[model samples]
Target: MRKRAKKHNYTVIIERIREMVRENGLQPGDRLPPERVLAAAFHVSRGSLRQALQALAERHIVESRQGQGTYLLADFDSVLPGDAILEKVSEHDNVLHDIFEFRRIIEPEIAALAAQRANVATLNQLKVLVYDQQRALFNNNEVDQFDTQFHQLLVAMTGNSVIAQVMQAIQAIVDTSRAPWLQSRKRRQMSIEGHLRIIDALEKKESDGARRAMQQHLAAVEQFIFDNQ
Candidate 1:
């Protein structure tokens, strides 16, 4: 859970750095503040800030010089803007619908397979993920990370590399849509409850029950996202 939380913090810091780039009119090759300054300004530990910077470096968005400091490697405008979140959703309405439709068809089957094949270790991991989701709720943090992990873990449990690849393929758009869908506390709570029910079915090793639980969960989530949109 601490690991997940730290990962979340890194993500937050990375996004904030992007925002800072745009807000401050940072250009490619422009140097960012020193690590210490950035850490203080961002109200995060230097270690956490460094992790975030390392992530950006991995993405080729920024680079750290030897004893020089970090510098922007790309323009922030090339990245998706926060304001584009809903706009992208609205623009790709049909695509989004099809994605949800695909999930509805695929994820339940995955859940069913997981119920049959999941080992004790795998089940325990899923429980920890859902528990992390509960903790995120209490901490008023985003639950989507854990939610995504839980679903992906279920796919992995199915023991089909092809199915796992398929899930990974659609992950980007799924992530885009999920951000707005999960913005509401009610929706987040609903997601947690849905995951709990699916976990219960999996724990009992009831493939049929897991299938039903997953189908119901996806249906409700899809309805809410489309209805409220």
Candidate 2:
């Protein structure tokens, strides 16, 4: 029953809502602003806003509870773009190696920048993500999403829009690369330790230490992948 003409507008609106969520620090289970307020913020009609929310609900990105507002059910990339290409690349035999190499080259620098540029708010957000990662690991639950969020948050803290968008584009590939390794508790614990080290360095504003922590973390990931293969 949806109109084809509104599809493009709906997608744009969806991305805007995602941006709002990120900018506002709305985590999973966090309620969004009221419908009229959101519509006003986005400069769209209430009807159009409802349409976009409905689309997001369909993807399980947001859920509307009775007598309450819509809440985030998952992270931003829960519904990634370019699914066809993502699937093709993720299935490639060397994808994990490629992702590891890419992260090694980029993420240490991101950590270093985060050390230099992160304000208290940014550091606090990173801390929240680290604890989220730990909780996920302790529960023996899936950590791929939290793992991806941790890395993506690092990239975002760099205050570089280009880097953030580029990382976002390839996040699904990175998630695929991380999935197999996180299946082992030992590997997950190693990752958690590495993230803690990075956080410590960032909290102290030690650029070199942050960079070193990230490098060590990625090296461990590379070693794990090498041994498993």
| Local accuracy of candidate 1 as per-residue lDDT tens digits, 1-229 | 1111112455567667877887899999999989888889899877557756765675577899998999999875574446342233234455656777778788899999999998899999999998999999889986778888988899999999999887798789777557542246777888989999998999999999999999999888877755543
Q: What is the TM-score of each candidate against the true structure?
A: 0.60, 0.57
- State the lDDT of candidate 2 residue by residue for 4-25, as single tens digits: 1212344556768888988988
Least accurate stretch of 10 residues (summed lDDT) in model 2?
Answer: 1-10
Q: How large is the C-alpha RMSD of every model relative to the true structure?
A: 10.1, 16.4
Pairs in clash, predicted candidate 2: none
Instruction: Give candidate 2 misplaced runs (Cα > 4 Å).
Output: 1-93, 180-182
RMSD of 1: 10.1
TM-score: model 2 vs. ground truth? 0.57
Question: Model 2 Cα displacement at 200 (Å)?
Answer: 0.8
Clashes of each: 0, 0
